[model samples]
Target: MKDFLTLRLYARVARLGSISAAARECGLSQSQASRIVADLEDGLGARLLSRTTRAVVPTEAGAEFLARAEAILDAIEDARNVVREGEDLQGLVRISMPSTMGYLEVIPRLTGFTELHPALRLQILLEDQRQDLVRDAVDVAIRLGTLSDASATAQKITTIPRVILASRRYLDKAGEPITPADLTHHRIIGGPSGVAAWAFEREGEKVAVDLQPHISVNDNEGAVVAAIAGMGICSTPCRRPRPEMLDGSLVPLLTDWARPPVEVHAYFPLGRQTRIAARSLVAYLKAGFGEPV
Candidate 1:
């Protein structure tokens, strides 16, 4: 019989795109994980992954095999669960979500979840970047904003208003703009798409204003810090507003003219048999966020 442990190691490594990361998750040495993957590749007479200094991407063949491998693994686990504990299931469920949200929201509620499912183990990957649920062996992903991809299933969890904000010190020194058009006159802290063109509604009419920022950043969190430090105005999802919003450090600028709310989603691959632990967690998240359908 094929070694199930070796197959699982291969799956984890492929999902993570790094031997070291898989090793850390599995509690094995990096070299050991590497050897196991190499052995699997040799036994199959196929090269499953293309490796580089920066990333490990699966070959077309590897991607196809990965799907089958996951099914096989799940079936095996199902059999084991049926034989051992009847309907009760127990195993590791790996999940990923945005770093800030996971830290602020999900991590705190995990204690109650663990208490309910004493036999299950949970592994969480906290990052700002989107993770491939199938490729990364991630069962679910919590994200904010619209999901353009039609292949996956996205469940809207909550809608949060988008707010434009700046530090009190910045507003005091630069003088707050009374209108959206005045934003072009001051420095704007921005990320990714940069200071988004202001879009608002007034008197039941749509209005749009272009914003010109002096500085640009690639990450929103960094921009939030810069905004809090009194650098410039920033646009961020209201759910992830800077901590200083509550304190005197940062304050909302265009509250009346705020952009439309953005939706938070819990995304996962459709049609797969979700593990019990993952289902429980998803239910908890849906309840906690109370997102409109």
Candidate 2:
């Protein structure tokens, strides 16, 4: 157990690239962590890490060892999961997702999950950009669009309905568009990149409208807010604007047209080594989405 804990500490130090931070997570002082690492090097007769005032990074040998150590730790965690299945989950789980999905979908579901595993520690990163999961130490990233050649393993969670929307006031001022082509003359609110083209279909007829946004945001929520303020028409998933549509703050356009659904994917940067807790949360999502849990 002592050796196991020491190995765990070393893995955290390597993963974080900060001895002080790793020590803090493991409930050890900086001096203690430093001494432990030094002792580990002395015992192995190897220079495991290159140390500097700014950062502590693994040497070539340490990098190799870290990969093996992480695999061992993951196996141990898997063993624990086998024994403690459905019990309280311990330790940290880092998750990343778009901000709007976090607020509308994931966060609300978290209460039920955390209540069951009160010992778990969650670090949620809500951003519209894709993160370098290995560098950021993210266990799972729930993405709400096409995978589109991302360098990570992805599981298709479910497809969500999409819509092109605008506020009533905006429509009143700009004059409602009759078809996809009319959008060429209208102000458009776009999200980030790769979404500049919007697709619509009706009665086996399909059209893809290329756009240059009058206003662009990196976040979906921002685009929705822009539309609500009567900035322009925006295309996004239906789940986000459900409440706004009901309350008359936003209106779905092109009722005769059907937009392609947004594909939801749960990305695993560690692939087969993804932590059990992260997988558990994804299973909960599968159940919620009416998929096979």
Candidate 3:
């Protein structure tokens, strides 16, 4: 039991890249966590982590050990769940999501899920950056677009529709764009680089627009706010600005040139099937997206 706990501590330190942070997560002091890791290394006769003042990185052996450790943890959780088949679910469910989507879409609807499972504790991490399922120790992740990583299993929750939009006042001042090429002359509000490209397809042809944004933001929520304030045109997922569109704060533009819809997926680490709390949350998300749970 001591060795198992030490192994788990080592895995957390390796995943977070910070011993102090891992110690906090494990409810241990920094010195105690260090001692535990040192004991683990001594028992195995191998140095697992290369520790510096600022960061902790896994050695080759540590990386190999981490893979097996994850499997062992999952198996243990599976066995525990099997033993408690009839009981109410009770555990920490750590979920990761894009900040904008999580705030605007999932956070608003979280109450329904929590009300259903009173014993379940939820830890939601809102980050736009890509997170590793194994390293981050995330039970579930709400992801937009395609799932490229082969190490995670993804279930499509919903298809988020794409739309080009502008504030009515902005369109009245700048003139509504009739074609994708006209966007080159318009002031655009967009994300840094990856989310700025606006592509459209109809029939057999495709039109791609490289937007030169007048207002640049790293988050979709910021870009949407800017567009609603009549700053500039924005091409984004419809889910971000649905309220604005409904209230006429923003108007859909260039409907003839349709942007491809993006898929919203619930991601889990590969290997074992998703467990109780995480699975229930995924079901809630699917239902919240207007699909049957």
Ten-residue stretch with the least lDDT total in model 2? 284-293
Write model 2 residue lDDT over 1-293, tens digit each, in one string.
77777888898899888999989978999999989988988999999899898898999999988888877876876777667788988767889999988887778778878998888888899978888887666888999877663557888887878788899989999988999999998999987545778888999999998888889888888888999999999887765447789998888888899998888889888434878888998887867776211
C-alpha TM-score for every candidate:
0.80, 0.87, 0.81
**How should the candidates be ordered by TM-score, best one leading?**
2, 3, 1
Q: 182-270 in candidate 1: lDDT tens per residue?
A: 88888887764443676776567676778777667765667777898888998766565455888868888766675767677877766
- Local distance difference test, candidate 2: 0.83
Top candidate, metric lDDT = 2
Count of clashes, each model: 1, 0, 0
Task: Name the Cα RMSD for model 1.
Answer: 4.1
Ranking by lDDT: 2, 3, 1
Q: lDDT (CA) for every model shown?
A: 0.74, 0.83, 0.82
Q: How well does model 3 score by local distance difference test?
A: 0.82
Specify the highest-TM-score model's number. 2
